[model samples]
Target: MIGVGKMKQYTNVLDKPLTKGKQEVSLSAFAFLFSELVQYNQTQVDNIGELERRLEDAGYAVGARVLELLCHRDKGNRRETRLLGILSFVHSTVWKVLFGKVADSLEKGTEHEDEYMISEKELLVNRFISIPKDMGTFNCGAFVAGIVRGVLDGAGFPAVVTAHFVPVEGQQRPRTTILIKFAEEVLHREARLG
Candidate 1:
């Protein structure tokens, strides 16, 4: 017997095979949904920083789920155990699965041992919605930063993650950079593991 509200069995989503970043929702549809997410969060906060935080928190939930799914389905229950390995997994596998492409670049910070940066020429959130001048420093990419944080934290590598726009030499729209600063315990663990 089938329930009225529930979906009829059709291979069950969990039983279906995962796609190789090829399956996608329409870009316009995704943009519209993301825009709605930002707007809903906007109504909940008093300032730009708070808004970003809320967006990040929302993203963290997604990131956590992504980590779990990838761990079980894609990697065959194997999780990366090294710092660089995890970062590379995020930059390549995770990004590909989420956005249909790998991140543009991943780099270690020049001035700090605890920092790394993942940069994209045009981040998905930043691609469609343009920020007005009044909303200074309000980056929708904060959600993606949250996603990164969630993925890292779920993988036992907690860190502070943030998104910023950096100017290019000749480009009009600045690139978005997700900066990750590892927690003290993560660094200590890395050293001990080494």
Candidate 2:
């Protein structure tokens, strides 16, 4: 077994410089890995909610780190201070980095004062996922929502993020709607600072 001291001696890969050029991962490799992730999580949980929670928890850490890297790559390591600015950053930069394309749209909720939606025709993460009918409303996009939540929380904007499947009439791939509900304190702060 590796000792704690020995483990600590390894260099942090995040601190290493990224090579300048296109570095793309194969979709098949990602899909296989993700499918294994789901299968492993499913064995540990008795219900869909628990499985989703496990997946989300796994994605959260990745999201936090991705936010830092994305900010470094796109904004010269500067964090967005405004609500809309952060949303726009996620919609464009984050989407591009993760999916090689931007999200289809970003829209504010009409009924709620502090809700925002990011819609995607086909989220890469859910490209090969097929939820059975018995799974009820289970959506693999919850992992992405958790990533969004982690990014927001790391940026000092706490929010609850959830994913819903909404199929479009003409779209081949079903739409994924990531709902972001900001905390009361965040809204109050935004109002005061806006």
Candidate 3:
């Protein structure tokens, strides 16, 4: 087992490099590893849906851990108490931390004040994924949605995150919009706080 000091050292090494505004990374390196991970998981899954679910679950775990680390890096700032505030924080901070860029758009739900949407022009994983005829239903966007869900839930938001493909004009890649539906209790609490 790794000792606490060793773990801290490793964390320090990882944190030191990324503390800067943004860092360039090799997409091919990440993509190759991700492909291998998917292939390995595919062996354990019985069907395509199961594989995708497993990938999403894995992303969720990553999100939970990432949320903690990010908050800790920010000196343990208290989680956002309002829906819009948290959504903005997620789009700006969380998106940058995870994807090196802020989301393309963030919109409020017209039907409900608690609901919000984060849309990305080109999700990293989907950039190179070409769905074959046999795997027409496969979409890696679920993994990203799971990440958002995990991050929000870990930060006490308890929201439902769903990924959808929204084709935009003049965009080569499919735009992914992640809809985050906050719990009513959260909104009520925020209202009370206000």
- Backbone Cα, N, C clashes tallied per candidate: 0, 0, 0
Candidate with maximal lDDT = 1
Mind giving the per-residue lDDT tens digits that candidate 2 earns over 1-194? 22434333328876656433454567998999989988898899998888888888887887898898877776787999889999998898887887888899999999999999999888898888888888988988888998898889889899989999988897665689999999999999999997
Q: How accurate locally, in lDDT, is each candidate?
A: 0.90, 0.85, 0.78
- What TM-score would each prediction reach against the true structure? 0.91, 0.89, 0.80
Please identify model 3 stretches exceeding 4 Å from their true place: 1-23, 75-77, 111-114
**Model 1: number of backbone collisions:** 0
RMSD of each: 4.5, 5.8, 5.3
Query: What lDDT tens digits, residue by residue, belong to model 1 across residues 121-164?
Result: 99987777789999887788999999999999999999999999
lDDT of 2: 0.85
lDDT tens digits by residue: candidate 3, 76-121: 6566656677777789888887788899999987898777888888
In terms of lDDT, the poorest run of 10 residues in model 1 is: 1-10
Q: Point out the worst 10-residue segment of candidate 2 by lDDT.
A: 1-10
How high is the lDDT of residue 44 in model 1? 90
| Clashing residue pairs found in predicted model 2 | none
